[model samples]
Target chain A: MKTIAALCLWEERIAPRYDRSQKVLVVHLDHGKAVEASTIAVEHLDREELCKTLIAMKINTLICGGVVDPCRRTLEQAGVKIIDNVIGSPQAVLSRHLAGALSSGTVVD
Target chain B: MKRLQTPIPPELILDHLAVGVFTVDPDFLITSFNAQAEELTGFTRKEALGRRCYEIFRADMCFEGHCALRRAMDSKSSIVRERANILDKRNQERPVEISAAVLRDKTGAIIGGVETIQDDSNRAALEKQVKASYSFGDVIGKSPAMQTLFEALPVLSATDSTMLILGETGTGKGLTARAAHNASPRREGPFVKVNCAALPAPLLESELFGYRKGAFTDARSDKPGMFELAHGGTIFLDEIGEMDIGLQAKLLQVLEDKEFYPLGGVRPVKADARVIASTNRDLASMVREKRFRDDLYYRLQVAQLELPPLRERREDIPLLAARFLQEQGALEGHTARGLSSAALKLLMEYGFPGNVRELRNILEYAAALKPGGRIEPADMPRYLLRIDCPPAGAQRAAAAETAPQSDSTPDPTPERSETERKAVTDALHQAKGSRSETARLLGISRTTLWRKMKQLGLGW
Candidate 1:
C-alpha cells in the first residue's frame, strides 16, 4: 500500500528524543519503494503543534526514538502508527522499515 | 586556611550529587553528562556527549528562549533556583529546579556553561496539596474571575432574592447554588434541590406544591413540597428553564405572593424559602422563542451569577486538577501525586465543553490508571485526545501567556493577522519594549506575550 512516513531527525542520525527534534524527514513510499522525500524544520513549533502538523500532513507512520506520552498518544489517536525507540541513520531506518524488519527499540550498530 | 595537597575528582563528586549536572560547550554541544543527568534525560554519557544541549533538555523554556543556561551565559552570572521542565526519555515531562553558571577554563577564558537540574515533582505535588486549603468550601478557584465571584458571594448569600445561576453544564452551577444555601442566613433550614427537567408536567406540579390526603390514588396523606420543607432556607431549582409553562406560571405566583397552595387544599401556605434557579440554557433566547416565560426569567434574573466556563479561566486548571487529583486519588487509594507538565498542558489546551465536571472526571480516571507516581499524559483519559484544540483566539491567548520579550525587528506578512499583531505592537510601544510590563497590560505572561508577538511577526 502507498504510505507516507516521517522520521524525526538530528543531523544524519534519527533524533533520540521525538519532542526535541528540530527537523523531520518525510518520505513517500509506494509498495515498499521510496518515491519522494523532503525535510521539514520544526524548531519554531511546540510539541502539540508539531503533532497537529504531522496529522495535517496525513502521515501514515512515524519513526523516532523516545517519544513523550502526550505527543505519542495524540499521534496514535490520529491514526499515525508510531515506530518508537528506533535508532539509526534515517536512510538505514527507512531501508529496514521497507524490508519489514524494523521493530520498536531497534538500535543500529 | 590551608588547601589539601590531593584534591577530590570534581567529576566523581558531580556524579554523586542527587541533582543532574551537564555541561555544554560554546556551540551548545554537550561536553559532560554526569550520572544523574544520564538517568534524568534517559541518555548514557556515551550518547549524550557531543550532542546539542537543546536535544537533551526539550523544555518549554528552551523552545521559548527562556533558557536559564543561555541567560546565565549571556549575563556572565549564575541563575539560582529557577523552575523549569524537561522531557525524559519516555517523553514524560519532569519539573525541575535549575541553576546554571558559566564554566571558565583555568586561564580565565570563557569555555562553556554547566547546569544543574534538581527534580521537583514531589515538592510541586506537596505545594499543590497545601493549596487545597485555599478552596472556598467544595468550590475551588484562585483566578480573578473566581475571586470576584467569591467577593460577591457573601452579599448574595445574605439576601433572600431569587438568584439565577447561569453556566454551561458541569461548570458548577449546582455547587454554586449549594454554596449559596450553606452560606445563607437560613443555614439551619433544609436546602431542597429540584431537577425541573426530570419530571413530567403533571408530576412536577405535585412535586413542587405537594398534595393533600386523598388528592390522588397514591396520595395517602398530606405531604410538604420542597418549598414548604425549605421554609426558612433555600430551594435550588436546577435546569429551571426546562420547567413547563404552566408550572412556570405557578412558580411566578409563588415568587410574587410568597405562597403556594397544596394540590387539593383550599388553604395557601407561606413559602418563605429563598429560590435559586440554575440553567445551562440561555433563558433570554428561550423567552424570545416563547419556550420560557419572560416574567419568570426576569424574576430569576433579580440576582444573577454567571459562572465562567473552565476554558475562559485557564489559570484555575492547574489548581482544580491538583485538587481533584488529591481528592479523587485519596478516595481511590492511588499513589498518584500530581499531573506531569505535559498532562497539565493538555488539560489547559482542551476546551472543556463539560467544564469543571469534565475536569474532575478526567482526573478521577487518571488517578485510577496511573501506577505510583505523578500522573503522566498517558494516564489521562484517552478520549481527551479526541477533543479538538481550543479556538485560535484561546490558543493565541495561551501563547501570549508563555512568551518572553525580544528585540528583533518586525517582519509583517500580508496574511490576515492584523488584529493580534497590532494589539501586541501597540502594547509593546506603550510599555517601551519592556516585555514584563507589556505582558502585564495584556493580562498574559511575558513568555506568552513574546510568543504572540513572534507568531504575528510583530517581533522578529
Candidate 2:
C-alpha cells in the first residue's frame, strides 16, 4: 500500500528532535517507489497546530528523532506512525524505508 | 587563586574538566566528545562521535532556529553562558548550562564550533535554595503548616494502609502521593496512576480491573489493568472524588477484599498493591449529595492527609518564586534570575487562587515576556497587578478603608513603586549610605540602583 511520510529536517540532516524542528520534507510513496517530494516550513506551528497540519495533509507517517509524549500521542491518535530517535540524512532514511529495514530508534550512517 | 605554571596536554585537560566538552564540524557532526560530556549526556564517546550534536545531546535549544552551536557558527559569535534543558539517554530532562564558540583556523576562516556543558540540576537547586530546609521529594515548603506535614510524612509512609490525600487543585497532591510511595517499603515496586475523571465510568472500571479475552466485543487478548501492573507497589488514583457512584462500590469491594475478578473471568486475582488516592473535591459534600459512595470514602480515608494551599504558606513565596523562575526552561532565552524586591513584595501581598501552579504560570509568563535578568513588578501579568494588595494575613484590602487619615501613617499597603522605594531606603540605611554597598545589598548594579534612587528622589 502507498503512503505519505514527513521527515523532520535540520539543514540536510533529519532533525534530532521533532518538537524543535523548523522544517519537514514530505515524501509521497507508491508501492516502495517515490512519487513526489516537497519541503514545508513548520517553525511557526506549535505542537497542536503542527499535529493538525500533518493530519490535514494526509500524512500517514512521521520520520524523526526524539519525540516527547504530547506530540507523539497526538500524532498516534490521529493514526500516524511515529518512527522516532532516528539519525542520518533524509534521503538515506527514506531509502532504508523503501528497503523495509527501518523502525523507531534506527541509526543510519 | 594562583595560575599553575605546569603545562598539561589539551586532551588530558579536557578529560579532567568538570563540564562536558564537545566540538562539532561545520556539517553539524560531532568531531570530539570528552569523558565528562559522555557521562553527563548518558552517551559513550564512541556513540556520540560522528553523530549530529542534536542527535546526541537533544538540547531543547536545538529546535526552531535556536541551536546554540549553529547560532554561534553562523553569526561568527559566541554564547558565553546560557541555560538550556537536554533529554538524556534515560529520557530525563536535565537542566544544563551551555557555552558555545565558533572555531577558526589560523587564517581566520570559520571551521567548526566548540560547546561546553555543565549539569545545572544540582547547581540551580543549591543556588536558588528552593530545595532549602524542608523538602519532601520535589515538594518544598518551610512554613509551620508544611513543617508539621513534613513531621507526619514518616509516620504515614511507615504503614501500608490506603491513604487519601485532600487538597485544593494543583496543591501537589500527586507529589505527596509519590513521596509516600518513595519512602514506603514498596519503593522497589511499580507505581500506577489513573485519573477517574479523565475516562468514562465503563472505561475507568476496565482500566482499574483487568479483562480477559472475549470479555467484550473488542477484547482480543488478556489486558491487565493499573491495579495488576502496580503489584507489590502503589496505585495512585488521582481525582478519586470523580469516580462514579457504581464504580465506587466495586472499588470499595477491592479495598476490603484485596482481590478482584477480571471481566468475564471466574478466577479472582489477588491485588498485592497499596492504594493511595487524592482529590481536590469535597468528598463529604459529595456524600451528602449522593454523588460519592460513603462506604468507599470511609475505606479510602483510613489514613487521610491534608495539604495546605500556597496562601497559608506565604513565607515560602520567595523561595518558590526563585525556583519557578529557574524552571522556565522552554523560554527562548535565559530565564529570569530572581524577583526584584518590589516583585517579591507584590507576590506576597496578592492572593493566589490557583495556588503553587498559578504562581509558576505567572513567573513563566513573565520570564517569557522579558528574557534574562531579575523580574520586576512591571513584568507581572496585568491580572496580578490589577488586584489590590492586601496587608499580610488579611483576606481583603481593608487597609485603605481602615488606615488613619495621615500621610505620616504610611501607606498601610503601599503600591509597587512605594514598596520599591522603601526597600531601597532600607538597603541604603543598612549599607551606611554607600551607593556601591547599597547596590550589592539589593542585588543590582550600582549605576542602575543609583539611577532608581535619583529618579525616585530618595535623597540618599
Candidate 3:
C-alpha cells in the first residue's frame, strides 16, 4: 500500500499554478503506494485545504514543513498518515516513508 | 580647716533606687548590697554581704572565666552593657544585662565595682517561641525521598515557575500542590483547582477563561473564571492529560503569552496566576500517539515532580493508615484503634494499582465495617482474600455458566484456562498488544491486569 505522498512547495513556487495543473503525485512505497493531491500551493495552503486535497486523492499520508488544525483534522478524518515535518528536500521524506521507519507528525526543524 | 558635714544615710538612698545595684570587691566577693539588689537576687543583704558573688548567685558564668566585674576592676574602667546569665535564689536562670563600673576614690584609685542588672529572660523566651512556630509540623515522613522533597520545597515555593506533579491517584498530589502554594510567596493568595477530566470541553473552557454575559444558554451573567479568581496565586490543573486537544492548544497559547480572552469577550485578559499541573497518565506516550499535544507537554513540564507510588514506598503505609484511622475516627466520633499485624501485613503485601488513594479507601472501608473494634485480616475486602487463591475456580464457574447448553456434542477441551489464554492472546493481537490500553479495555486495574499479562507471558 502506498501509505504516504510528499507535497513539494519549492517546486510549486518555480512553476506557476503548478497545483491546478498537476493536482496529484503518485509514488511507490515499501509496504504500499500513495497518491497526493492539493488544490493550493504547499507553502501557502492552510491546514483545511491541504486536508481536503489529501482526502480527494484518498491519501492517508503527508510530509510537509508546517501544518495547522484544519489540515490535521482533514488528514485525520481521511485516515491519512503524516510523517515527520520535513524542512529540506521532499525526496528525503519520500525515502523515509518507503523505509517504514518515518515517525509521523514530528517537527523536523 | 575643720568642716562639719551632715551624714547621708546610704540605706535610705539605696532603698529608693530602681536599678539593682551591688558592690563587689577585687576578690569577686559581694560587699555592699542595696535593697533592690537583694530583691532582684531573692536574697537579703545580710545573707549576701560576706559571700562570693558566684557562690551566692550560682550564675551560669563563673569567676574563673570572663567576669565583667573582674574585668572592670582589672582595667580600672567602666565595663558597661555586658550580657550574661544570673541565677536567683529559687534556682531559676535569668538572662541579665549587666552594666559594671569601677568605683574610684577621690585619689582616682579603683576600690570596688558597682554593677546594675536588668532581667531579659522574657525577651529570650519570646524569641524561642517565634522560631518554634515557623516549622511545618504534623506532616510526617522521614524517608530520603520525602526529605529531599521537603528540602526542595523552599525553592519551589520561592518561584512562579509552572510545576508538573506526576503521581498515581492516591499519592497526595493535591496535598503536595497545596503545600507548595502555602509555602510559596503567594501563600496569602487563592489556591484554586480545576479537575480537567470532570467537565465537558465547553464548560471547562468557560470555567477556565471565564465567560461574558449571554455567552451561552445558562450564562446569564458575567462570571470570573478560575484564572481570574487565582490572580497573584496558583491554579492547580488536575488530570491534565484528559483535557481536550482544542483546549490544550488554547491553554498552551495562554501559558506562552500569559493572556486569554473570555468565551465571548474580545479583549485579552492577562493571567498572573502560576500553574501547577498533575496527572497519573503516561503523557509522553500520549504525545507520541498524538492523543496529546507536544507543545503543551513541553510547556507544562517546566519543573516536573514524580511522586512514588504507595507500593514503592510501603514504609509509609503504617503511618498513613494510622493517620487515616485517627482522622476518620475523629470525624465519625469513634475511638480509633490499631490494625492487627496480619491485616497490616496483608495490606503491605498487596500491590495497589490505585496507589495511596486505594489504600485510603480500603482503610476507610475496613474502619466502617469493623464494629467499633480493631480491624483484622478477615475484616478486609473479599477481593483482598482472593489474591492468594488462583483464578481457576472463577474461570471454571464463568465458563460453565456461559457455555452453550444445546450443543450437539461437547468437545473436551484441556481446561478453561487454556480457552481464556487463547481469548486473551487473540484480544492482544487485535488490539495491537498495547498493554496499557488493553488494561483499560479489559475493565481491570492496571496492576491486576499486568499481573495476568505476565502470568500469560504476553510479551510486547
- Evaluated with TM-score, which candidate comes out highest? 2
* Cα lDDT tens digits for candidate 3, B184-297: 889899999998977899889999999998888888998889999999999999889889999999999999999999988879899999999998777897798798899999
The parts of candidate 3 lying over 4 Å away from their true place are A1-109, B1-140, B389-460
DockQ of 3: 0.00
Candidate 1: misplaced stretches above 4 Å? A1-109, B1-134, B334-336, B391-460
**DockQ for all models:** 0.22, 0.35, 0.00
Q: Backbone collision count in every prediction?
A: 10, 1, 10
Better of 1 and 2 by DockQ: 2
Arrange candidates by lDDT, descending.
2, 1, 3
Return the top candidate by lDDT: 2
Model 2's CAPRI class?
acceptable
Q: What C-alpha lDDT values do all the predictions have? A: 0.79, 0.80, 0.66
Each candidate's interface RMSD (Å, one decimal) is: 3.1, 1.8, 42.9
Query: What lDDT tens digits, residue by residue, belong to model 2 across residues B142-250?
Result: 8988888887887888799999998766578888999999989999999898888778999998899979999999999999988999999999999898788889999
Q: What tier of docking accuracy does candidate 3 attain? A: incorrect
TM-score of chain A of each: 0.95, 0.95, 0.58
